[model samples]
Target: METSGYTTQIRDGLFDPSPRDSIFRVKAAVADELAALDDTARIRSTDFFNHTFAPDFVLTWPDKAERHVFLRMSYDLNALVEDVALIDSHDPFIFGLTPNEGTEKDSRIDGAVEESGAMFAEPDALERLIDRKKTDSTANMLSNAIAQGGRGTFIGNEAVEFASVVSRGFEAASDVKAAGTAEAISEIEERLGGPQAWRMNRVLQAVWEGSEGPLMLFPGKADLSGRLNIESLRYLVTYMRTDDPEFWKRVGRGLKMADLEHLDFAASRPNIERLIKANLDILSARAMVLVDDPLGVGEIDRESKFSWDIRERRLTFEAPGFFAFIGATKKDLESVRKTTANPVAVSTFVDRAEKAELAEVTLHSGSEVFILKHEDGAIDTHRLVGVSGQFDGPSEVTQAIATSSSGRVTVDLTAMSGTGQTRSKIRLADLLVTATPLLRDLPYEDTEALNHYLAYEVDHGGVTLDVPDDEESLVDDGVAGGAEPDDEDE
Candidate 1:
């Protein structure tokens, strides 16, 4: 007969007929042979076998200081003899002991017994393992969803329902089948949509299903506090309104609110406005813009100049004598020129402006106010009187002024104490350093820095001041009092 491995036979009448005596003699003989292989080995009857009443012996010993290994051998006689041979030689029958070589039956019994022992050792081990596996599978699903652009792919509760199905399918399967089921579930989950995807999908549905687009569902202020992939939302709107793959890619990379300021939303204006209102809290000034004009009226007027305060989210149109302490770039200045009527003035401002972090811009009917914070914490306020239409470039400042306490130095270029004062020509460059000594060390020529600084200031506050034709004052009254006026007219 075929056996797993080596086998040995013993004469049937070698021991007493009594089962207990016979078993003892058989074990004693086996122990002698086992000792030759490992002196420390011990033999025990596991009472597990392939056939009824047949027992299996386990030989276990320490292989290393703290590690143990075992071998199993089964004792059987009927399995070894043919049917005809067994009938003829029933009296002089031979018994055989065959070593078990990790067969399917032996493995299953070992696994069951080991698991039972483990349950006694740690009651929550299996549960913890299963939980960990589930968590890992979920993480993999999310990763795949993100990598495959699975955003907005699912409907409400669909992802959860699919996950439940996968779980149930796994549970109904056998151990071997369960492994295959789990793998298939992982692949399927990767393709299925997730929570964020479902949210996007819902938004898309709302936009397409209603006449007012997303505004029909979220009219006043939509709250999208935790959503990070705003690009997808932008893509949806942009795709519906226009087909610009390059712009879409840029949106995908992530566009600032300022970037979208120039983009024409067309039919998707309501959707874009909804998105903007929903994320106002998280939108920085550099990434956002506030327009005073009506939506879808006409092309943006490139000649109208405006100043933006980042912290206050204020925008001032055609404001004169406003200072932008925030950073700006040539590119940003060019973008501003396109929206303003006075490109020459913007170009001029671009040539002279410097980047600063702690300045405020306010427009007064007859005066311009500038608040300057010095290195020594001293605040100097400078007011420019009767400087109308003098500095009309796109001015953007950082948000530092809005969030800062009153301790901040503010330069209000509003109408000064003297309304009908004689105006003297003063160079804009001289006014900046004279108002704030800190500006002397800063690079005023870097337009890039100015663009960055403008982003912050415009978000805070942008004040518009009307210049009265009567107050043509050009003299630096406050910090620039001692400086002599240049011969050239400003």
Candidate 2:
């Protein structure tokens, strides 16, 4: 039988049927072994020897003060063993005082430093996903602006203007930097597609149409508050129109008097309800960012040095002087994807469109006159249609694209903030790269003192052998440090 991974089952064979008797016997055996050692030898070996008679048996004397030690071992799913010794002492844990009096100091700097460094050293996978989403959204927003020919769309000779008045109020209160300037936004929009640009403008106009004052969507008012409020409107419209009980329950806590009236009106008409949901989905799918307060606030900010505080739901900016912070739960972010049927295909097309940088082009179905840049490696086959129109179509764009490219499509739907946004893992090898600057900044006297202290600690902390009873006689006989080596030649 394959019994290697089962530590408990394997160790059980060593014991009698009764657990109490087994424990007693084990303790007796350990005590018996210790009794054989002399006081001097015991003291010397305590700090020197780590007695591992078996995988389950671990002993550490470390010194006369810390003789009582317990072994802890566990196996992971991969059958890898982790072992450690927890020492108990009558003397306080550190500084040679009673446990209650001594303020135990963790002198092992290496361990604490390594643990603190891991968070910043290794970039989290989730952070990478968020970064990609940010880039995609920025690109999409810029592309949308570019497609509009540096102007808003018109309906029956009336130009559809962006709700600049409402947007200005948000802009002034918050230091939120739009993903791009009007020119860049317009340029990218043109490059991606004109119809998409128009659609985007229309969506923006719809949200800002009736809003005269600050719309408080969330509980707090800080940077990116207004923008996130606008984004949440999409979900609000859907949940209210569809009468989603759970969504309503959650929103009820945050809803205002004006919001209640608006929802009541939206829920009254079926066509308006459908229109709102469709438009919201379109906005969410095109480019949206979901953050878990990457710029930590309150209790989290104090605890994490203002890094991400997912537990408290406080947003934090990765870099200093960052202007905006949007926070949301993963569930809220994923809901956008869940609502869309052909996200991958649309995402892939957007990526390609951004890459090509065309001013305007037709979709696959050859129905909608959209703006898309044509590059050397552009997607030529499998046309898309009705992308500009509501219910234009949902097709297997992902499957079609997959056939052309062997590489997998990666689309990140969320963006986060933190140091991980910029750098990857920092290994031990990076110590020189990181520490040199700090070392240079320190005064020569401090550096010398630091070096001397480290050397002294290293020398004193090292284990040493006890002097032999016949030290002089052994030295005279050419035996040193306890044992003499046998001459292989002889």
Candidate 3:
């Protein structure tokens, strides 16, 4: 009922008695209708059906002439009264009473909760909706009641409004268009709160499943760009891990993203390993290990084979490659950070024979290692190693190779090098042995071509990389210049 020119807000889809005796009187008036049933039409629970988008019932009659009676009451007077005959013998009428039923001429409140987005599909789908909805709510009171077979309603218009909003969201999600980025789905999440947000997540997961193209979230991050091929799957996985506890365990077990198999296994190794740790289904583990870019951990004793004990929450793989090992190290570090524990126990081993000069260097949390390997040929360039915990800033460690008789390698951590130089040399050797593949792509070319370009740009600070507006191309290939190009500017 209207209070002080406004409707009092109901809490948890249940009637909240106002301090004024007026609303309490309204509740008492509705309760009086239960006396007509004589206990034959039992109310298992007093459901605020309108709060959940369902019609309200006033009373139910048993052996009497009128089997069901609906009271539409306003604060001042009773609205239209309905006395309907029970057509079905199995049907038992439930009561739902709203405060403003009689005052307004809206007879369209005949719709039920089954007509709303809460029950967008049939019974099975409806049950799923309730379960998911329950999980989304911070208070489990409503969900607990719902799970305990408490189903029915007391209000109408409010229920209709709630249903309409949810229905629109469901319809929007059902469109099944793949949002190109994670931020788009985040915006969707902001728009669809609570139960609808979960549905939206499901819709995104479905869209990702059906799509054939790669979806990139956080596309600007060069490493995370082409690597994250499985559209909104990451968002869903993250959501389940951080927000909804039940869905991740129940529904996430059946989750599969075939596109994960197509990700650049070597480049996305870290991400794939993290995903495995977070989700850890057989499909994910197999995708991580059996993909085209294999971990390259050669066969060992049968005991050394990869194993995942889901029940125990333990994962083990013996003699994994540098990529897999680094990935595991990162995951272990994450777990440690979460619980504020020391992560020194997670270790990687290298055979001493292979790592003669530098062996048994543990790359754990708070550790840094940089390597500079010199190229033997005309390139005269070096490779900078990118270790997980290393390279916090510009690397101080640099190595120079002299192409003389012995082909000696000297480590330089600035000209005044003693202890720093020694440490650099050892770390460089360890890095070379452990992370050769990552280092290969990042060759540091300290050639004259680059030097000359840098010098010219420094001398004329206004120089921009883009070609001048008058010029046809950045480089003067044959097509842009005359056949016999003069040295002097034309």
RMSD of each: 25.3, 36.0, 21.4
Residue 374 displacement in candidate 3 (angstroms): 5.5
The runs of at least 3 residues in candidate 2 whose Cα sits more than 4 Å from the true structure, single-residue gaps closed, are: 1-289, 292-407, 410-490
TM-scores of all models?
A: 0.22, 0.15, 0.22
Supply candidate 2's per-residue lDDT for 35.
27
Off by over 4 Å in 1: 1-231, 235-255, 258-264, 286-330, 335-490
Candidate 3 C-alpha lDDT tens digits along 256-363: 333343334333333343443333322221101111113444334223223211111223222232122111111221221111112121111111112222211222
Tens-place lDDT per residue, model 2, 1-490, is: 1112122222442355876665544444333322221111231123211222222222232122222222222211121111112122211111000111123322332232222111000111112222332323222232212211222111111111122322332232232223322332343243224343443433332233223223433112223332324334333343222333322222222222122223333223332233322222111111112233234334323322222212223221221112122212122222321212222344344443332222123233234323333334444333333443433564222211111111111122112111100011111112111221121233445434333322211112222211223333222222111222223201
Stretches of candidate 3 exceeding 4 Å from the true structure: 1-110, 114-195, 198-304, 307-374, 377-490
**What overall lDDT goes with each candidate model?**
0.28, 0.25, 0.26
Model 1, 246-365: lDDT tens digits are: 222222222234434443354345445434333232232210111223252232422222222222222211112232322111112212311222112212322222223333233222
Winner on lDDT between 1 and 2 is 1
Pick the lDDT winner.
1
lDDT of 1 at 444: 41
lDDT of 1: 0.28
